[model samples]
Target chain A: MDNSEDTERIASVLNGDISSFEPLIAKYQPRVFATVRRYARREDEIEDIVQEIFIKAFRKLATFRGEAPFEHWLMRLAVRTCYDFLRRHQRNRETNLSQLTDAQNEWLERFHVSDTADSGDAVAARELVELLLDKLSPSSKMVITLMEIEGKSVKEIAEIMGWTLSLVKVRAFRSRAQMRKHLAQLLKECPVTVEPIKTS
Target chain B: MNTDKLWNKLVDEVRKTPSGHSVPHDFEKRIMDRLNSTDAHAKSGDSSKIRSLDLLWSNLVNLARQATPNDRVPFAFEKRIMACIDVPLEVVDGLTLWSRAT
Candidate 1:
């Protein structure tokens, strides 16, 4: 019944006071949502992934030793969940030029053809960046998202993914190369205007 | 082609992630509802599994009841089962439909 603190909330939840889980979810929902903002494609998908993370946390609550702050443990769980989510979606799907919105295609064309000026809308450019980033292999996507977007340190990523420091470094390098390669291919092949489908 | 410049540009732009996105307002209620529904589903699943087990047990009992020596065309059934491996049929007639469940 105590709704003031996370520790008491965790204790209450673990004690079968199922209603206490509401506070934990309320307190950490933002951070959990933060973990997948860049990685998840749509708003509903982000919510679904966040929901799954909380569900998993609820199921695995008994295993949560109080050795670390609950936030740290939750973030680690969040990271692992996002990594698993990316792995599940690692199927090879082609990223055609048509997938890009008209604005994104224009931005890509201008960025490639013109000078290195700031495109002003960092948001849109970032979205376009993710469009290409999503086409990479699962491991590559995880490495890049963990290293670049989330700004997690190499050691932290290593700990989270259970990979050696060197392995993490290698994966990050290869992932960046993969992203660059895809971007290069996209830039070379992008037509000025996408052709509309013609009906027979 | 060297795409390092483009990649770096994207990196710089994306680094400052905006803080406008917020967790949905009814997120807590939604999660509680989900947990309750999951518990309900698990309970229903357990009950259904028990019911199905009972049904299967009754099915087996019925099957055993009909397993009497005279209840089956044993020779015909044996030949039919063995015929798949090229064994010769016992040439028994008048027992082609020796099923009990019907």
Candidate 2:
């Protein structure tokens, strides 16, 4: 069902029609899990996070005014839940500048270049990208993931992350540039050729 | 390339990046199960006669308002209201008698 229908169903569920929530879960579970997985490390961790997000959403359903789409509101909750997870774990502990290893630097270099290569390199590139994301400050990584991977607009990212529009744009730009620079250096070191098209 | 084009390409590349995991099949079922349980709890806990009485009274008032002045009261309106009150009074008397006997 479309968003409007889903919203109406959710409203019905909120008003005591419990059966209406099933379709909402079916429609949104993928997006919700994907959002949670972006920040969570283990499968169990993600599962817990997803459950908490839904429980929180249901409890707060009475407050939903339907001003924005329900998915947008859910995404905001997902992002907040991830941030709370990160904070609780203290996972984004600061990295010392002088402690960078050669292997770590090389991995970072490979990560940025993965985007421009052929399909064969995609898997390796993605792994590297994941590693590089782990190295970033959690906030920056989240901003980049939401805006780039999830295709959220800056306004939506701001709403989700609870940041101003300018802040979201600034962080997104910097994150992309950082990734691009690292990837470009890797590409220079290991050049891949693209075949030219021949006209018959 | 312009920043707009570069941004678009970056976004497209990111979108194409596959996630290592898929959402479990039981995810929705689990959520629905929780919602259902919560709803059931709420319904059972909400055994308030006051709310139901309010709803019934409001509905009755609405029905009366919708009727024409000539058709406002049924021929047996007084009898129906008296019967409704008498049934409840009889039930209360029976309950009181049982309580006294026990």
For model 2, how does the per-residue alpha-carbon lDDT over B1-102 read when each residue is reduced to its tens digit?
Answer: 999999878766765667754445466699999999999878754543223323322322233233212112224333332333234224458778999999
Per-residue CA lDDT of model 1 for A1-200, tens digit only, reads 23237778888878867666665766666667666765666676676676677777877889888877788878888878887887877774456745667766666555434423343534546665567667887778778767765568999989888889999999988876676566546655666532211212
- CA-based DockQ, model 2: 0.01
- Candidate 2 residues lying further than 4 Å off, grouped into runs, are A92-116, A173-200, B1-102
The lDDT per prediction is: 0.63, 0.59
Cα deviation at A132, candidate 2, in Å, is 0.8
lDDT of 1: 0.63
**How well does model 2 score by local distance difference test?**
0.59
RMSD of 2: 31.1
DockQ of each: 0.01, 0.01
lDDT of 2 by residue, A1-200 (tens): 98789888987887777657656665677777766766765677776776677767776888878888888888788789888887776664543433334543443344333322233333333444444455566777787666655557999777777799999888977876665544334333443331211212
* Residue-level lDDT tens digits of model 1 in B36-63: 9999999977665444333322322233
Candidates' chain B TM-scores in the order shown: 0.39, 0.27
